[model samples]
Target: MRIPLSDDNGHQYRDLNGNGVLDPYEDTRLSPEERTEDLLGRLSLAEKAGLMFQTVIEVGPDGDLVETAGRISKSPTSEVVTGKHLNHFNVHQIATARQAATWNNNLQELAETTPHGIPVTISTDPRHAFVDNAGVAFSAGPFSQWPEGLGLAALDDLDAVRRFADVARQEYVAVGIRAALHPQIDLATEPRWGRQAQTMGHDADRVSEFTAAYLEGFQGASLSSTSVACTTKHFPGGGPQKDGEDAHFPYGREQVYPGGMFDYHLKPFREAIARGTAAMMPYYGMPIDLTVGGEKIEEVGFGFSRQIVTGLLREELGYDGVVVTDWELVNDNHVGEQVLPARAWGVESLTPSQRLAKIIDAGCDQFGGEECTDLLVDLVENGEVSEARLDESVRRLLLVKFRLGLFDDPFVDVDAAERIVGRADFRRQGFEAQAESTTVLVNREATLPLASSIRVYSENVRPEQVSEWAQPVATPEQADVAVVRLLAPFEPRDDLFLEAWFHQGSLDFPPGLVHRLSRIAEHCPLVVVVTLDRPAILTPLVPFVSALVADYGSSDAAVLAALRGRIAPRGRLPIEIPRSMDAVRASRADVPGDTENPLFPVHFGLTI
Candidate 1:
């Protein structure tokens, strides 16, 4: 076993390099800059290359590292941690909090056996929400579930945002997750964009306010042992998808700004940087022939554009934090039977090695969803990419690891993780938030706060949950009122690896579903609740319903409680519901609240 050296004040520090003497990086008292520089000096080419790659990893049921088959490349945890020297990972699925904590400890123990004894820094995408798209966000399994990011924005409460982040931070630190890969902060300028639910909203001011609150809650007043470092993402914003197609596919690669509102998208990111966000992730979309501040930018994806990543974000904005690219920028991804092309976008002509070199040249410190350290090492050894350049990124990566207190103690209390995750109080808060965030857009004739004794016919609501609030009847004709729940509409597509999770395409309801709802409305006083995953065209249904409620991933009981007036909904519309698809097509993607004759303006919510 390795022993620690004691200082004059009795504070012990681990001899990480096993050099038989205290090194600056091994000393806890030294400044992060000094420690980073010292660690950079001691690392080999292979070790530094490992620091540049941050890829996805899976945990087995018994707390052992396992490889996932198909699309997600599997690297054995032991080989990746010790042999490959990779210390950063984005954990995918885990059975339980205790198992996750045990798995983390196992990974850290393996790292201790390595030459430098570097503890792994585990990170995750947003996990405290209801959405569970593998490529986007994960569901709140074994954790408290809240509304999606847009749902939080709909509440328009800064304190609520802070509370959610704080609770998530506590749960994450307990499970040995040191970094958060989210709090997207991207404006939902394009209503049909698949990832809008992950954003704060379309308004720059509100997005800015929430961004600061989110960062503060995750990082605390300052980063410490208890804090989880936050990565404010899709940098410079990613809400301007052309034709509402995501940049994950070839057709959706272009991010257009037809309204000349490029700077508007950058507003929230500026606020995040001011609040001291630890890291930033550029999006996959390329700015197609757009000009910002009288200067024409290169028509390339943000990950490959030195002008945007280095010039705009690094130099112009004065941000010096770690810059990580979005997934699959270099190599093609295998999603079951389908293969996704590398999102090189404008640089599709370049080889894999050339793409990796371009990312380094763009001033990115780490590559997300990629594990090609060999290519990076080869580039450095061949003199194509200089050692000094590699050191710059490795230094930044080390600073985050050190700042996160990973070097001191990377393990967690497995028992504590079991006790802390999804605790009763956390669950209560989440449930309460769900009720509070249900937006009541139309409540004509004071129709809400339904009587408990009244007969009610419900559709899409669980029979047990409906029975809790009112008398449930089989037919709409036999009931005093009909309560129906509907999801926002989307055109489905067949694609590889979690692409189906993205609810993209037309927001208009299909004819059959529309007819069913219209027929239900004809029978009795109808109360309709629509979950707004994306802004839906509600012109047809709006006229038929007696009451209209909007939700973003709330539980059935929470919706019933809100309807019963047990908890009043304070949520407002985060995105405007367009009158028709024509208006949506005519409006510019980069501009917010531009829909012509919107059915309901943003911030439109009512309470009886």
Candidate 2:
């Protein structure tokens, strides 16, 4: 079919009386082919650039931002979210079906207010499980729950990942969640990272495969049907941080690639791009400190790196999709905050107009963490930015909307969201994943799956939870097997840190708890399951127990399913579990942020 001529395709220049030179904003009556250009020509420069930025979930307001260099300075001012024009709208904290519904309505309110009525595509961080991060808000919400990424990793089943994504889309669609902001395919190369729970399991090939499958489900073949837009994130992969710390903060932004993990880090991304991912969300970290561009910046990860985004992702990988910034505008402590461009705040050196220009030139289609419209509107009237550019972005954004079938089916099924948003099937899926995700790392004497009647003793251990797998007992003398779940211990970096990551910081484990558990392990074959979100250094118990398991229990049901052997344990450790803490500390910290560590390279999953 010959495509009709349109302004977007340069067909609108066909006017016999038209000037040879293209106008910045065409005001002519455009044919169907010339409509895009004509519309774009009508926009002033400022309106063109504003389409590229977004407001965080709660930051949809306007305030008196001191205009320095034509930019708003967010030094500290009261702002009210009055604009409807936002590239992305993040609604964090998925509380309940009702809450999600309400949030959806609020987002629609903003969408309806856009200049062209550009619907605010409400996106969410993972909301299926207990991620334990309250500040990010979407960790545990009203959506139907699923096993976290680790659980999916354990199953090592791409089909399972796809099914899970389909289910998640259902829940999201139910509550008006049009876009999903995850599938962090970054390989887990650093074991100490407390945040690997959200990633697909630990192998480049495996992660890539599952990531593709997950995307397949999220972006179905037909946009006119059950499809949800998804953003494959932390582009180029964001796993190899210094201490497994996220690149969200200054401490975690330096991507050291001393081990040369950069090349390997790109596999999953390659796969994701091949699978037709609609959107890409770059992380806050940049490879400035590494050889990515053979340079070092004091801070700022790849999110703003024009080299990485335009030169690499666009030119190298051939990804012609929309690029959205991470949540930088939100003052939230969990996600990156200092991430918003200095332009968005109207800084003195680089005006807001300049910031918007740089972000667009850098290949960012939308500015996340923001919802400002006046700034862009004002700039357009002044002819600082071109309206044609805004039209370009609008075209891209509209394409995604078209792909998601939002133009035809925008509203979520209020009834379905109520019916199946948190249905039993989803819960069962979580349990199933849990069982498959868990791994029995050590079982020297074949002491696990203890006899029905066996004595067990352990402090802070739930003997009853495992009673079905083996016998529960008061004394260590009579138990046939002892299952002790070890809680990894660590000291918080500061008061605020503990308050944000953990529910209670002051609570201390009873002393000699390991010693007592060791006695139980010695009495019978000991099976130690470490219920940790992050790796809790388990070397101390290596010699004491016969078996060890790392559940990283974001989903207890998945853990339980893994224990039952209903699902295969395919989740290889995303990051290397050091034999000792000293090993990790001695290793080079300057690994590339994009690739995997050869130390425990990607796809090292072992099957039992």
List model 1 lDDT by residue over 1-608, tens digit each. Answer: 33345454576787677776678888888987888888889888899998888888788787876744323645677767776788999987766998899899888877878778888889998888778887888889998989999889998999999999999999999999989999898888888898888787899998999999999889987778888988888988899999899999888899999998889999999998898888899999999879876889888889998988899999999999989899889999876577778899999999999999999999999998888888998998899999999888888889988888888888899999999999999999999889989999888788897878899999889999988767999998898999998889998887755567788899999988878888887888899999988899988888888899999989899988998889988899988989999999999999999999999999999986
lDDT computed for candidate 2 = 0.58
Model 1 clash number = 1
TM-score of each: 0.97, 0.77
Tell me model 1's lDDT, rounded to 2 decimals: 0.88
Best by lDDT: 1
Model 2, position 523, has a per-residue lDDT of: 70
**RMSD of each candidate?**
1.6, 8.4
